[model samples]
Target: MKKLYIFVLVLLSWNLQGQGLPGLGAGTTPNNKPILHGKSWVAITGKPLGASAGATIFNQGGNAVDAACAMIAATSTMWDVLSWGGETQALIYNPHTKKVIAINALGYAPTGATVDFYKSQGMDYPPQYGPLAATTPGTPGGIMTMLAEYGTMSLEQILKPSMDLAKGYPLEAQTANAMEAQKARIKQWPYSKKIFLPHLGEEREAPEVGEIFVQEDLYETLSKLVEAEKNALAEGKSRKEAIYAAYDRFYKGDIAKEIVRGTREQGGLFTESDLANWKVKIEEPLHVNYKGIDVYKLQEWTQGPALLQSLNILENFDLKSMGYNSANYIHTLYQAMSLAFADRDFYYGDPAFVDSPMEGLLSKEYAKERAKLIKEINDPKIGPGDPYPFQGGTNPYSDILNQNKEALASLPADQLNSSLDPAFIEAFQSGTTSVETADAEGWVVSVTPSGGWIPAVVAGNTGVGLSQRMQSFVLDENLNPYNLPEPGKRPRVTLTPSLALKDGKPMLAFAVQGGDSQDQNLLQLFLNMVEFGMDVQEATEAANINSYQMQSSFGNHEVRPGAIVLRKDTPAWVNKELVDRGYQIELWNKTSGPLNAIWFDWKHGSFWGGSSDYGDDYGIAW
Candidate 1:
């Protein structure tokens, strides 16, 4: 009963905090509007309650890493967090150390996952869903890693709100809508059905708004992890040591053994050693300069550098003179994106495996040469450009991809044919939620945790949903050296969380989820902030264009070829001009991105933030 009282008080406080930002107070509006919170500290998440979760951590004097992890933990409980079986990739900026670190909290294929293994089973490729699509979960260890490296808080403290939330929490509109819509899919997996579709009557309907959604199983799973940490602490482990102990329990102990046991019992490819030896990569960030600002993103394992390559090419043109959202500006955006993707197709592979032409790809000379390919007329036949005299060679992956061409031809490929509209692609690329946070002292963290949603399955009731990221790995060999299904190779991914620095200090930190569109989304938002002189809120609300001219990062990997998706409200002249340029344009009522950003104006000593929606309580603060 006391717990119920505390929860009620928290709800009341959430209502009160809703008044934090003017004009966005405690409303039942489905869409959160964009707003500016110019305080010394701020946070932004997909849901208002999520931001509140971070606020609690910040109030406890937690740094950006702690607060961001806290909010994500809360997110993992409520909606698509664990259910999506996705990995959490993050970029953390420490003002004290004056260094930015990249956390490649990604999954790798099990050792037994060989392309030939699938070929022998009458399957040319790994299944896009089910046990075959899974990898050892990285979220559990990823959060622990951050807490050990940068956070002052412990796992037990950070996960408290999330644990409470798992017991029960009110449903938001998007989450409730997803729950109802995913019923049929979730029902196919008994464990998923048990968590999401526990009905009291013969007729099971989607839970209504404000309904209390509960997940005792997930809570128990998390509790066990926390208990493991506590046991270590009780045994005289330091805070960091306790975190490591918990990591061992999750990855090398009972949990790992259970997952392996389940996999063998189910005839899956995973083994106990697969979990025991797995490790997340702590890589140095790839740095690029757009004008004077230094932008950082994960290396080739993610499609992060695509932004650098595209922006480099776009810099050759007079974008400002073309006008924002105008047909000329939109055309240039599409053309530059096409040329950059051509380079990305052949060169942007795992640097460790492939001789990634990184040095040449980011060179201004390469951008200048690639810039020459941007034409007023659309050309679907466009392919890769030379990064240098020695590099940018033949399409290595094409020969193998061609061999399996017939295999992909027989699969459920290119759902974009349904509408080729923004709605379809938006649902594809931007289906995941994003979170960002910053402390008063200049620490910042930006994260995008996506994967696991389309066809979610529990790892044998371990409460860790496996990410379907195997969909990103190719069965064809030598096609993309970086993403081959080797035992320890990281799959080249579409998740890109970015950080911007000016004068060797943190300036802007943001991230968005839109698959390959993440590059377009981040580029637009960055340009919106730097070029247009828009504040974070204005930049977030600014209408942007999306180009689908490149091969998809997932699915059957069909190229969109001269395709551009625009907002429905774009000036008719923009559409007309694009049509005249031999382009395919499909406009929709919504944009393909939901951006969350926080800006640090070091000179003025102020922090500002905004999201896709505006509510008085919208942006994060206590």
Candidate 2:
């Protein structure tokens, strides 16, 4: 009788709140992982070893910037879907400046990477793999720049973790399996075959799980960088100067010469000048104030602004009143995202090369205008809006828009559908890894570093994998005039890192690892916390909807209009409503995440880190 009475009282409490589960205020929530508590610092990333690197830095008296650099190096060395030669995109919140800054380390197209060059080869877009797709390396410059500008540690101290990993580390199952799966492609590159396939003639050419995976060439390259920094420091150069000394060696010294020679050997288009001219830019990030919280993201060069635009449009709706994951709420979020992503697909690109109407695109009035287009159903034919008029300029691409509409109208019905094949799914969900770090001193960092996955083209004896980001560029202007392939132009990429501030202090730092689905998942994660009242952990683990309306930024750039993915646990009635509303529903066991986030518990003066249990994501707080 006592147990029955207690259960009845609990049920009554939930009924009184008018929701299925008590969210943020609840004593507990359903989760596979507990919220990490930290008083001094927290480090979270795609792998356990990566987080360990950050923790090591933190323990060595290094601040968040130094720790973040160490984790980036460690992960890059570990080949966690990235390499030393891949590009890096980051958002760092500096405690001293009380500002969030963007790091643009994206590699650019080489000298001969012209549209005509690709067209001469009978290709509409750049090839998805191999030497033809390589770009000027950017990750090395990015790390050195950040360390010199904001970090307190020396280059040697920051790079020690990666150097150790480069010598040898027990290979994990997933990476080993990936290498084995793509061994044929890996064997195509002589240098890659020499390093990755230790057992060439055996049944398994790639290293097995628990085997010591070594990269002697990469270790030597790292040692050379440290030697440069040490030589400069010994000569009485300042810490910043010493770091730049290492940077110079990588870009203009022996390292650069070797990279150029090796790349040319693989039929790549790299020149010494391409590597020497590349520099990392530390610039102001773009942000929007949503319901009193400021959300920051990288600029037009990345697809980040789309999330800001989606937030601006969503502000017009009363989300909480619609109930979490309800048909109405899902439909509203999907429509807003569709509107924003349509613009992203057509307009977002390298701002240095194109005059993207960002001032108007991010305008609240423009969002209000876009919001008015949202109806009770999804719009498969959704296209970019005219933001030029909002910014008081005339539309220069009006004729281009007309031609796009005509092209869409001419497409066959079957071709418009989503391909469920393994290959297509692989392209659609092309992966990256995220890094999130925070400390008691108020420094915060979020990074989405990617490019070199498995089967990468290793540049001769350097053991460094070249970036395959060139495939993101379109050869034809009609597809995206702003993103056409050209020499020295950075390809518009999917890498984005998010930071939110409230009351002039850090509120959240979050990022995810899906290709095109990154911002889509991030948008929902933000909403789940602010609107639905879920705590950071709940928000990170929440099942979110995914729309396949936007063109992919990877292989073939396919778009599957009206298709949406829902979690298998979605209510039948809600699923039925969505199908009736014209959505081609696809049930997924997990809709979108692997999201990693950190929330500032101001009231408690501590950090609450959330690492979703879906993937290899891990977090360590102390």
Could you say which candidate leads in TM-score?
2
**Overall local distance difference test of candidate 2:** 0.89
Model 2's TM-score against the true structure: 0.97
Best by lDDT: 2
The superposed Cα distance between candidate 1 and the true structure at residue 369, in angstroms, equals 1.1
True lDDT of residue 524, candidate 2: 94
Clashes of 1: 18
Residue 536 of model 1 has an lDDT of: 70
lDDT of 2 by residue, 1-622 (tens): 9999988877676443333345233735446788989999999999999999999999999998899899989988988888888988999998888989999999999999999999999988898888888888888888898899989999899899999999999988878898999999888889888988999999999999989999999999989999999999999999999999999999999999988898889889999999998889888899999999999999988999999999999999999899988999999999999999999999989988899999999999999999999988877878898899889998789899888988877877666775456676678778889999999999999999888778788887887888889999988788888999888999999999999999999999999998899999999999988987777787787789988899889888888888888889888999999988878888888765789999999999999999887788899999
